[model samples]
Target: MLSKFVAAAALAGAVVTAPAAAFDKPQTTYKVFQFPQDRIPRIDGEFSDWDMVPESYVVGQDQMTDQDGGHHNPDKTLNIRVKVGWVKGLNRLYFLYEAKDDYWDFSLPGLHNDTFEVVVDADLTGGPLIDVQHQDIWKPEWVGQRASKTDPRVPGSLTHWYSHGVQAQNYHIMTPHKDKDWAMAWGSPTWIKNFPFANAAQSYKFTPGQSGTYRLEFYITPFDHADPEGPERSVESKLREDALIALGWIVIDYDDVKTDAKNGFWSLSTQRPMFGLASDLPLFKLMPIENAKLEARWSWKVVDMDRRLVAFHDDSVGKATGWHWDFGDGTSSTEQHPIHAFAKPGSFVTILDVTGPDGTSRRSKVWDVQLR
Candidate 1:
C-alpha cells in the first residue's frame, strides 16, 4: 500500500507546478521531518527524543547568514542547530533548538533579551505579517494620523486589531526566558503562545551574561487565520503529509548587556525582514515518515449520519496489492476505498485485511462507526 501511495504521490507531484518564490534563495527548500505518531517528540528539554531524526534534517548555523553583519564569523562566537518536525494527525510544528554561544544574555525583562524568532506562513498566504506593514495603514493619508490614539489606523486601533498576524505569524522566543513568557506572538493574537496552543521547555547551565550551551524543545500551532479576538474565530492551518509551507527563523544574539548593541541577527532566510514579511520566508515541505513499517490501518467518516452512510479510506502502509473490508453487516467489499450504508443502527465489528508483498495485516474496529 505504501509503495502504491508513493507512486501515485510521485505522479501527482510531477504534474504540480512549484509555487512562485518571493524571497532570496528561490531554489532552496527545507524539509520538515515527519515523526511517526507513536514516536512523537515530547516537549522536554532533552535531546534524546530527537535521536530518531536523521542528521540530514538538521539546519545548522552554516545555513544561516548574519543579517545584521555584526558577527562576520558565526562559528567563532555563536552556533546553533535547529530541527523541525510534525506528527501525522497533529497541526502543531515541533522544534528542537540546540545552541552554544560564547556569551548568553537574557537578563532583560523585555525584547532586549537573546531570542530565537520564528515566522510561519503555513498556508503560503504570503504578504506582510506585522501590523506596521499592513497595506491600508501604510497609505500616504494614514501616515501621520497613526500617532493619534483615536485614529482607527493606529497600532491599537481597529485596523491593527484585525490586520496584524491575521494571515501569518511571528514568534519572538526568548532563548532562556526569565520572569516572562516563553515567547511573544508578534501581533494582536497573543493567545497563540499560551497552553493548548503552544508549550516549551528549556535546559541550560549558564547564568545571564555567562557562556554556555542551551537546549530548547517546543511546539506551536500554525494558524491560517489567528484572530486577535481569540481562537473562536480563528482557523488552524491544516497540516498534511507532503504539504509545503513557508517558514523561517532568526537568532537574535545579544552578547553585551551594558550596551544596547546586539551581537548578530542570524537568519535562515536570506532576507532580514522575514520576521515581519511572510513573503520573505523560505519554503518547508512536510515530509513523510522515513522507513515506516507496513501496517493495516483505516479511517471512516459518516458521509450522511441520517442515512447511515459512511466513507472508508485505506490508510495502510507498505505495498498493498489487495484489500478486503468486512462491514460487519454481512456485506463485504474488495475496493481499496468504499462507501457503505448500514441497514440498521447498532454496534458492529468492522475488519479490514490488507495483503502486500510483506504479507497480510488486519485491523479491526469495534463499534467505532455506529449511528443511532
Candidate 2:
C-alpha cells in the first residue's frame, strides 16, 4: 500500500502542468533560520529556547499590513512577532509566534476565534489550492449561496475529496485554544495536524476576554503532494539547506464577540488572497547555520545489493581539507565521497575521519551497512 501511494504521488508530481505563479514580493526574500540538530527549539510555548535566534530573524509587526482596509492599529490594539526555522535532514518547519492584544476574544466555539493562519507552498506549484478558489468548478454566482452536499454544481472530487489542500496547505491555528484542537487543517486530509506531521503548544496567562500576551510554538511538515486520503498517499517536500519555499501568515484578529465582523486581517504577504492562492506567498529561503564549528558527519546508501556496492556522502560542516574512510573490513580510502564494493555480504561498521584547519573530527556508524 505504501509503495502504491508513493508511485501515485510520484506520478502526480511528474504531471504538474501549471507553472508557479509570480511571487508577491519578487524583489525581496525572507530567511528561514537553520537550527543545528542539537539546538532545535522545544515546543513548550516558552521563549527561552529561542534566545539563540538573532533579532534580524524576527518578522515583527512592521512587516505585516492590514489588508482589510488598514483598520488594524498595532500600537493601540494588536502587536505580533513571528520567527521561522528549519533543521537540516528534516522535512519540517518550526515557528514561534508572540502576540499582545488589547482584547483577546477567543470565546467562540468555531471560526470566530482569533487565529494565526499559515499557508505554505513548499514546491511553489502555483495556482489556487483551496476548493473555494477552483477556477472552473466554483462559480462566482454562488458567492452568497448556501452549500449543499448534493449540489450538482460542486462535485465531491473537486470540492471535498481530492483537489483542495493537496498541492499546498493552509493551517488556521486558534490562538490560545481552550476547548478546540490547536489548529484546523483547512481542507481534506485533516490528519495533517496529527502527530508525525504536526504539533503545537500555546501558553497564555489571561482569560478569553482579558488583554495579555500570548506565545505559541509549533512545527509542521510541508508536503509536495498531500493526498486527501492520508500520509500513505502523500509526498513530503524534501527540505534541504539553501532551498527556497513559499510561505506566508495572517493574524485574524476578532475584537468583539457581539458582532460577526472581524477586527483585521494582518498578513505577511502583500497579496490579499494569499491564504487560498499558493502563488501569492512570499519566498522564504532556508538559511545555513551561522558561526558553525568544523564537525564531521556522513551518511551512506546501499547502491546495489548484488554487487555489495555502497555510496558514502560527506555531510561535514565547515571547510575540510582531507577525509579518511575505514570500511571496517581491513580496508580504507581517503576520498571525500567514495563508492566501494564490499568483498562479501555482511554487516560492516563504517567510519569517516575529516581533517581541516580547525582540527580533526571523526564519525562512525556501527554495523549499519548490511549487504545480503
Candidate 3:
C-alpha cells in the first residue's frame, strides 16, 4: 500500500508532465459501448432495460487450484463473473454480478458474508487524490466503497465509503436487492459531514437472474464536497472526454452462516489504490461524443415580400466531408451545403445526416423550421 500523500504527489506529477494525445487515444482504446436510455431503469430489483445496455467490459474469478491439483477454495460455487455497462445520459455506471450459488446469505456482521466492492477513480485527467484519507486534506482524487448485502440495524443494505481507515460516508437501504425494493429517495448528505466527495452520491439495483446467476446495476454522481450549500455537480465534468479513469472490482463470499466470528472467504479484484500516476493503474477512457449532434446553419434573403430561398449548411460536431439534407418538402440534397426553397409552408422539419468519424455510416439530427 503506497502512502496516500506519496501517491498523490506522484499523480500530480504525472498529470503535469503528461504529453498531449491523452484525449484522443482513450477515445478509441477505452471506448465505452453505451446505449441511449429512453427511460432510466428504476433502482428497483428489476433489470429488463439492462439488456439494451452494451457490455463494456468483463472480469471473472473462479476457484483456484494448487500445484497438486487441490481445490484452493472449498466453496467452488462462490466463483463470480462481473459484467459492466455505462450510460452517459444517466451519468450512471451499471454492473452485473453472476455468482454461482445454491442459496443466498447476505446477513452481514463483517466481511464474512456475500458482498461486492467497487473502486472508481473519478479524476480521469489525473490529479492529486483529494480528501481521501482525511477531511482536512483536499488533493482532488478518487474513492472506493464496499456495498454489503444487508445489515440488521442499517435497513436494506449497508455501503461504507472510507479514506485511509476513516469512514467518510454511510448509506442505509440504498442498495436494492433481488428480493427487496430499496431506493435512495434523496441525496442523503447528512449521513456524511463531507458530502459531495468524489464518488459520493450513488444509486444501485440488484436482481437475480437464472438459477444461480444474479446481476447488479449501479451509478455514481461525484460532486464538490467542500460546498456548504449542497448542489449536485455534473458527473460529465469529472468523467471528461478522452480522460482516463481507473475502475476496480472485488467480490467476496462467505458461504452460509453469518456469525460473530466470520470465516470462509474468497475474493478477486484489480490493482488497489485506483487513483495515482496514470501508468500505475489500468485506465478506461471517456469517448469524445457517444452520439453525434448537428449544427444547422443557413443563409437566406427575401427575393420578394413573402418568398425566399435558403442555402442550408451542415455544421455538425465531427470532421465530415459529406452531407445529406432532407428538406422535408418531398426533396433532398446530398451536397455539403444544400439550397432549398420553402413554398407555402407553415412548419417543416429538416433533417441532416453526416457520416461519423469512422466514415462508415451516417449520423443524423433534425430541426423544426417555421416560415411565416
Instruction: Give the Cα lDDT of each candidate.
Output: 0.81, 0.80, 0.40
Which pairs clash inside model 1? 1-318, 1-319, 1-320, 2-318
What are the per-model numbers of colliding residue pairs?
A: 4, 0, 4
| Order of quality (TM-score) | 1, 2, 3
Give the Å shift of residue 96 in candidate 2: 0.8
TM-score of each: 0.84, 0.82, 0.47
Question: Model 1: how far is 260 from its true place, Å?
Answer: 2.6
Per-residue error (Å), model 3, residue 14: 16
Kindly provide the TM-score of model 1 when superposed on the true structure, using C-alpha atoms: 0.84
Residues 1-372 of candidate 2: C-alpha lDDT, one tens digit per residue: 013443354345332212223777877788899999998888877768788889899999888877764554433478899999999988999999999998888998988898999999886665676755455644312212223455435546334445567778999999978899999998776889998799988989999789999999999999877877789978898776766788999998888788767777889999888888877888888888887778999988888878988999898987789999999888999999999999987888889999998889999999888888
C-alpha lDDT of candidate 3 relative to the true structure = 0.40
**Where does candidate 2 stray beyond 4 Å?**
1-21, 69-76, 133-161, 328-334, 343-347
Report the C-alpha displacement of residue 242, candidate 1, in angstroms. Answer: 1.4
Worst 10 residues of 3 by lDDT: 162-171
Residue 142 deviation, candidate 2, in Å? 23
**Looking at candidate 2, what is the lDDT of residue 271?**
81
The alpha-carbon deviation from the true structure for residue 127 of candidate 1, after best TM-score superposition, in angstroms, is 1.5
Per-residue C-alpha lDDT of model 3 across residues 1-372, encoded as one tens digit per residue: 234563464345232212223321322233344433444544454667556544444455642121111223345455565655555434444455555555455444333334554434344333223233323432222433333454312322333222221111111222223233222212234322231222222233332221255455545443323121234322222333344455443344434453432222332222232222222233454443344443333333333425646666553544565677777677888887666777765566667766645563343333445567
